[model samples]
Target: MNYYSHNIGDYAQATTHLSLVEDAIYSRLLRRYYAEEEPIADNMTQICRWVGARTEEEKEATAQILTEYFQLHEGYWRNKRADAEIAAYHVKAETAKANGKRGGRPRKEAPFSEASYGGTAGNAGSSENPPETGSQANQEPGNKNQELKETSPSPPTRASGFDASTIDLPDWLDRDEWCSWIADRRARRKPVTQEAARRQLQQLAAYLAEGHQPGAVIANSIAGGYQGLYPPRVQARPGPSASRAQRLADWTDDLRDVLASDRHPREKFMGTIDATH
Candidate 1:
């Protein structure tokens, strides 16, 4: 495949072969990430805010900008490394195998057998781990992970960014406000008074920011009026004390112990603790 085919964003950015809407998005993304120091998605939302097309016409314009922005350029495609050593190693191995010649013996791996590792033989009856070797002793969690964890990555709670469904942004506003509200909503559990209302709009604007204008959107959102929705708190009233506080709390003791482990599947999983809390 050609370099352009490697990335849809690249192809879209390469030429004006797409619709007006597509061109607009492609233009924004390029400027945001390459020209300006904004993220791709951020740029899209900002464009959404600026276009502010509430009707179908506006949304279409916004979509066009998105398509174009997603189009990565050839330089980025070239910059992206693909672990050439890995491919080279595989090619060499394949060539060696095809030649029907003895290429080389496999390197010996570190022995992990319990018999060869432990200090004594009779203690094998016990169920415990053995002493760490120098190689293992030097290793940290990252070195021996079953899955590679991203280094310097944001926590799962927030990274790249997080989904702000908890805030429940309104549909009336543009993209800049939407993203802003979500980000701030997670940071603060509740909004109070006019500051709340102010935050709501600014947040909406921030949410409207495009992928390329993420930082810009975030700034607008911080400055705008936005109010987060929170459920009203209901105060619990005291009921007639049928029994004393201590007596009522002690009801669990009075309830007869019943073993119904045989009646349900959960009981099978519970095993010994099935009868207790």
Candidate 2:
């Protein structure tokens, strides 16, 4: 899989005791695991190299994190959480494939009723605009309007005819964001089918259960241009004083800027701010 969900709160809480380097190593290992959709290989040297752990400290951190977080199963190191995610991904993929083979979502046929038969009979005349008759003729204007609405043909069985507005949204879901997401899909020429929407909501509910905000989860998919919903990516939290990792990253960017501008690199060491104060 090219992508996987990363819960920032969960990761931050779990890695609170880890040093910056160890945290970095852990992140790289997770990326590899998700991309490969399999357990990390049991070879320590190869795993260290794959995650770019060159120094002794980095290598040791790599080994320590792997031992503490992953369980050695048979010949590979496995993470229970990662395994469960991969399994769920496969199940959803297979379901979508099967749905496609059946020519999109199954049509929801409106149940036939005597009222529907009456409506059909009302329209049976050859006239282009059939005259209202029977009960329709004797009803008040408001009642006539109601009868007309009830008699309208149900939406066609085609996928395009699925009305998203009629969807029964959950109370926890934000209505505006949901409508925006639907609009985004339609603008991309990828209309959401009823079944697809139902499945996405089900998945969204699971993410919500994990303490993810509904808006953030939906926004993640919209930003990524993803047709299916996914948990939001992890974001670094800000602090009054930058962490060592943040400082190093800022320093790297400043170095590049200094080089490009032909200024003394020492003029700004940690960030764009002048260092000579």
Candidate 3:
């Protein structure tokens, strides 16, 4: 696996006490681990050299971080989280490879309907209707001057860009919009496989079930050019009651100003007297 998921918060919490050099070493070791898809050899001299821990302090920090986050078994040190993520990546890659062999996703077909054929239900096989000549026969009933319009064929549905055979998508997602989004990603060189699409749908569904508008969520993802949908970052704003309270406070200040103005002599005199005290 060339890449893996990294949670900033979790990393920050775990490496809070480490020095900058130690942190760098830890990050490099993690990259090496994922790149090799296996544990590091349980040789301290080789580990220190690999992580560039030349100094005593650096060496101590590296060993500490490794002991705290990794487990040693059979003369190799392994990170559980990294191992699990690499395993998942392998599974997804294999699934995508198999899907490629099966010739990609199948196109969705529109349901057949009489309206789609461009004729009214009673127009077919009606004995009462008499055959007319020229334009009259071609024209629809009441509008004699207007010729019958041909029903246009429906627009072709877009391809899903993923392997349909490997993924079972939910009906809530708009297939056309989803396909268009995937195509856009591919054009940007951010192609996603069927497994990734399935995961994205799951996340999107969660946001939708929380009362988010599907259109808004999808629009946000498209505008940001993100491969996955995430919850919107909603800033905290004053609510209705808070706004009303602020308005009332402003009104009270205005009233006080008016009362203090010379236009009201008696009130102004009282305000001056209070100020003097």
User: With candidate 2 superimposed using the best TM-score fit, by how many Å does residue 110's alpha carbon deviate from the native?
Assistant: 20
lDDT of each: 0.40, 0.75, 0.66
Worst 10 residues of 3 by lDDT: 264-273
The digit string of per-residue lDDT tens for model 2 on 82-143 reads 76566556646765776698788556657565443244555555445556778776665567
Q: Top lDDT: which candidate number?
A: 2
Better of 1 and 2 by lDDT: 2
lDDT of model number 1: 0.40
Write candidate 1's Cα lDDT for 1-277 as tens digits: 0111134664545555766664554444443344332233434345566545456775776665544334435423111111122222333344456334543443454544555333346776453765556767666434634233433343344123223333333333335544555557556654333234334344333333312233443444344322332212223433554335544343322231111111222221111235575
The residue-level lDDT of candidate 2 at 210 comes to 62
Lowest lDDT block of 10, candidate 2: 114-123
Question: What TM-score does each of the candidates earn?
Answer: 0.18, 0.42, 0.41
| lDDT at position 254, candidate 2 | 55
Clashing residue pairs in all predictions, respectively, total 63, 0, 0
TM-score for candidate 1, please give it: 0.18
lDDT of 3 by residue, 215-264 (tens): 57767667755556644445344455556555556556545444533234
In model 1, what is the error at residue 13, expressed in angstroms?
A: 7.8
Clashes by residue pair, model 2 = none
